[model samples]
Target: MSPAPWDSEPRAQGPTGPCGLQFRPRMDMAKLEEARLFIQSMDYRRTTWQDDDGDTILHIYTAKGQREYAFAAAERLQELGRLDSKEHKGKTALLVAVTANQPEIVQDLLSLGADISMCDIKGQTALHLAATYGFPEVMQVRGRERMPLSTCLTPLHCAVISHGATMKAPTSVQGRHTWLVSLCQLVLSLISQEIKSNKTALHLAVKDGNIQLVHFFLKQPLPDMQAFINMKAHGHTALHMAAGLHTSLHQEDIIRLLLTRGADPSVRNLENDQPAHLLQSGEQGEKVRRGRGTSLVGECS
Candidate 1:
């Protein structure tokens, strides 16, 4: 009779500490072999045990990067109609795969019918976590196809917010922005989706002074570029956010870009304030204010 992996004292926890991905030292192959044999036997009592955290063998195997055992366990769980089972915290095995940064396992689980829309207690789906943590590993997995985009906040919004939070080098940020745009293109219809305050990803980029990302969104060959550029959140367009910035060099640049991209300066927000009305008072601001008028006139002509 094979002893269960957890039969020994001091059972290993796959996720620990603040990160929740600080896996114990490298997986012990000897134990992995034992788990594999046990799962292959399909013994319900040994394979279906849940720890105090409500993590099943599938969840632990996923977090520990034991691919062979994880895959076998996942299949068995699916047979039992519980592949998407959640831990106490609402994290499914797929979510654990993502948190563990195991892209291959993430792909395998998705192939095996893992629910992509499942979210944690915080209402964060796998895509949201991928976007929030800048886990391009997971992002690129679904990016391989026309990945379905769902959730209250689009992945674009999360990616844009994450891009701003990190202080990586310019080239690295640029690379990530490019990757995000490519992902957005796959689901172009949802590219302009909104979140809290009704802010779209474009509004977020402009608010963060991310001129490069702003350019990326505007430059895309989106079917409705005009509407996207002028899309409002709380009646505030990307142009309005740019115009109201505290007079930085990029503020004028962003204002000019938005106007050239057909942002309507006369479009008012809830406050009935147009983009021009929000311009800070300064030489730079005055220049952008004038630029907005010229662009509007050109559009009229």
Candidate 2:
């Protein structure tokens, strides 16, 4: 009975951000009722934000963190079965949830049929947003398999670059853990199955020194360390990752795992350098160089 979000009339902006949060600005509740009625009329199809940017009203809410209004609107959309609809950016409601680091919201969207693998114009996916924010929406996983949040970068690599570690799932289950964990686990499983650029999640795990994630990833049945641990992206391996971490329990463990799993300890990067060459070296250029190398493949090898 509901027309697709794409079939709906043009809207001014895409709604995004957190849902159900209290607001200080007193918007017309009557207007909200009207919006709700509009939602029902549209069969929960997302209102389009036909800007040049192509972002939807959903994108606006998630990016800006509008809590309650966004949540209410999102719920209406889910009920109408349009939660996965994308705007001009090729982003889904799941992507917005990942961007906002709202695990519960992410679960809600996924349950309502959001696709986890769609890439945006920027080649980003829900995982990229989660990893970029260091929000491990994954520790909730059970199996080794995972899926891509996007095409340009796996969630693991995204986690490595921004957080200097692995993407983890939230350990706590809370109220929405089942869906969150299932979604996170599915992503993980898909990631494990596909070895992009000849790298597995294990390779990525070691490269970024994500001890929890790395250790957790190895527990999966896929045991091809040499295929990945020894492999190089931009001339760096997980061992190179081991030397240049901020030092945490899991961080140290990832290094140990890589070494134990046969990550070449002596690999170097395009600059003929190793991660050790850049550790804690407060020289201005050193930080920049390290950042550059790490950004390429999740390490300063």
Model 1 C-alpha lDDT per residue in residues 1-301, reported as the tens digit of each score: 4444733424444655322333343455676676656777867765677777888888987877776577778878888888998999899999998877777678878889898888888787887777776666577777544444456777677778877664462336655765675556544453466655788888888998988788877887777888888888888888889877874568877877887888887788898877767776766555665664333322211
- Indicate the TM-score of model 1: 0.76
Top lDDT model: 1
Q: Cα miss at 234, model 2 (Å)?
A: 8.3
Kindly list the per-residue Cα lDDT of model 2 for residues 38-93, writing each as its tens digit: 55564212353334555555555555544334555676655555556677667776
Give the lDDT of residue 180 in candidate 2.
Answer: 29
All models: lDDT? 0.72, 0.50
Per-residue lDDT value at 284 in model 2: 36
The clash numbers for all candidates, in the given order, read: 0, 33
Give the CA lDDT, 0 to 100, for residue 7 in model 2. 33
Q: Give the Cα error of residue 255 in candidate 2, in Å.
A: 8.9
